[model samples]
Target: MVNSSEQAHTEIGPLYPTYEALRTAAQPVHPSSSARRLLWMLNGPLHSAITVLSSEITTHGVNMPSEPLYDPATDIWHPIAQEPVSTPKVSSVTVGVCQLEEWGFTWCDMHEGHADPPELEDEE
Candidate 1:
């Protein structure tokens, strides 16, 4: 078996320092290729967005009526003054994409339990 030290790679310093000076913001220290920059920008933005969305969903779940609680139905925010639903089966149900429309609730109204014009019309 090869020792871990034998697999090490060497770090190479920039070969063309003089040419890199033209692009530096603070006196142009080094020039980076456009591809490297594009890669960084693309991956950085996507990673940041995913992180933010994840945080929002988690916070919303906790803020639900039941502390550390989440519900598959009535996506609206409510503060239930009783023991939150803790059954494993109920918690594990995967809600299909926005059944609010079928339930006569518009996307926005459904999540917030707001009645839309159509839903209101049906009630009359």
Candidate 2:
């Protein structure tokens, strides 16, 4: 068995500096490489977008009544607070994706719902 003296000598020091160095070094120096740009886009913006979408969908049901909506059945669009449907289930990632797709919402790497156009300038 190891004694206290040996244990003290073997104890490792904090490695935060080393980790930071590695993280900084991993970034590509040149932005001209398409592959690198794609990877960067995926690792950065795409990841962030997915996280936000998952969080929003998990916290609030999809097709919120406060937001503008569309009904494929009638081929009509409803202004916000105009037509409200039952709250959609966004229990899991798959369910969220399905709900979004059903509502004609396309997942965007930069934004959550690409297909849903931004609100009119005056609405803001």
Candidate 3:
């Protein structure tokens, strides 16, 4: 059985397979060609930098912006790519739970709430 935390999914990013991974894949493309493809796909310098460093995998190519011709560039169209970032991106995620039961005040909640002398019920 798959764990709730585990996912049945593929996460394709700027560097999906990774340089090392691409080097080991079944039908590996040339690393230089790969880098060029990656550089071309990115919107600009910062985006390319973030991908080169943070993304799972980037096209195996030399992707310096100032030297476009030094390596050239292109994009590999396929299911492998889902999206591209045009700017430095910060991401966030949310987790959902159905029912989480706690035994006691989990630290501070232990001393919280109106457990002090019960206020005398106002006499009608």
Candidate 4:
């Protein structure tokens, strides 16, 4: 005979596997061949500067500019403040629950209640 807890877990379905699949799908794509070729063609100084900029962007996410502003004095184009880049908040349990819901799994809080799954911890 299956225990109540076991039955409950079964009803919740396979959450971890679904969460893993979703997380894998969410990974960033590599730069295309054309973009790589263009990077290769860039001059040494320009290439170095671009490489540094790319590294910084990768390390600390950049805020997308809403508008471009050109200053005649400095002869530089600057980005106006807009929406900031959002940090990633990965919760496997939450994602799994959402995925289950997407697959037509109905949750009853009154019976099962809210309990944090083992994989509820946020991933870096």
Question: What value of lDDT does candidate 1 attain over all alpha carbons?
Answer: 0.29
Question: What is the TM-score of candidate 2?
Answer: 0.14
Per-residue accuracy of model 3 over 59-101 as CA lDDT, tens digit each: 3444433322222246433322333221222122233443343
Summarize candidate 2's per-residue lDDT along 1-124 as a digit string, tens digits.
9998777667843222232343466732222222111211134343222211111232344333232133455765434213211122111121245666656433345476565787777755
Stretches of candidate 2 off by over 4 Å are: 1-58, 61-68, 81-124
For model 1 the TM-score comes to 0.12
Error of 2 at 71 (Å): 1.0
Highest TM-score against the true fold, candidate: 3
Residue 72's lDDT within candidate 2 is 51
Cα lDDT of model 1 by residue, 1-124, tens digit: 6554444322322232332233343442321221111111224343322111122132233223322122335553223313222221121223355665356555455567433334445655
TM match of model 4 to true structure: 0.17
What's model 4's overall lDDT? 0.37
Clashing pairs in 2: none
Candidate order (TM-score): 3, 4, 2, 1
